[model samples]
Target: MDDDEVLLRGRVYGTDDGAPDSRPLPGRSYRELVGGPLDGLLLDVTGWDAGQLSGGAALMTELGRYGGGGRAHYGPRAGDPRCWDWAGDTP
Candidate 1:
């Protein structure tokens, strides 16, 4: 509800199972995925550590590189600190 918080469209997933009603609080926030197959998806950073956040994770998506259910690889964008960028997809 703050001026800085912008509600985005799409599905949100986290380690806790349920998605937050809105953008989470600071350290327990979510990162939006931009470009590629997983665009618009929110990745929960609620309990992610430095390594997990930095190394990134392979997320499952129906729209894969080969056109089927597979994992989409996303990592922190070089200059875009607000969201993660799609690297590629895998089976």
Candidate 2:
């Protein structure tokens, strides 16, 4: 967390599978999606949970799973000042 940085917070539920229940972290999303968060999500976890994320953070990934179809995850990725992906949303 810094002046030029932002943090999207979420609850990490460790699972017996060790893979956990989160997505966007593994699937084919994190590379493009996490970089798009503007980013959790470790793999297919681009959706919502009992958590909070920035506007850009909400824009990318499979947010469809969260915010009841992304009602809470709406906004422009370019306009949001906090909407930035440190990885530049690249693979």
Candidate 3:
């Protein structure tokens, strides 16, 4: 599927056992994703539409710009395309 047609799953940056870890997207929605800062984003989806991915991307951008990590991947394991850049190309 296309990059825009993916259910992007985001994991906010957090500490685990005194170490850095990632947590699931608070609400998995644009509003929820922006609730706070995020550490990174991953496309945790089998299939989705453009709106969903776009929304996730938007939140990722916000998190990245607001001192939160902006790392992104396009795969079930967040390891494709190397990185994500919504600002350069919005859906």
The lDDT for every candidate, in the order shown, is 0.68, 0.32, 0.34
Indicate the worst ten consecutive residues by lDDT in candidate 3. 30-39
Each model's TM-score, in the order given?
A: 0.68, 0.21, 0.23
- Model 3: clashing residue pairs? 13-39
Worst 10 residues of 2 by lDDT: 9-18
lDDT of 2 by residue, 1-91 (tens): 4432233333121222334453224333222223333233232234534243443333333323342233223322455433334433221
Top lDDT prediction, candidate number: 1
Off by over 4 Å in 2: 1-19, 30-70, 79-91
Top candidate, metric TM-score:
1
By lDDT, highest first, what's the ranking? 1, 3, 2
Q: Supply the TM-score for candidate 1.
A: 0.68
Tens digit of lDDT per residue, candidate 3, span 1-91? 3342222234432323222334444444222221222323333333557655444443334333343434432221134332443433122
Worst 10 residues of 1 by lDDT: 1-10
Evaluate model 2: give its lDDT.
0.32
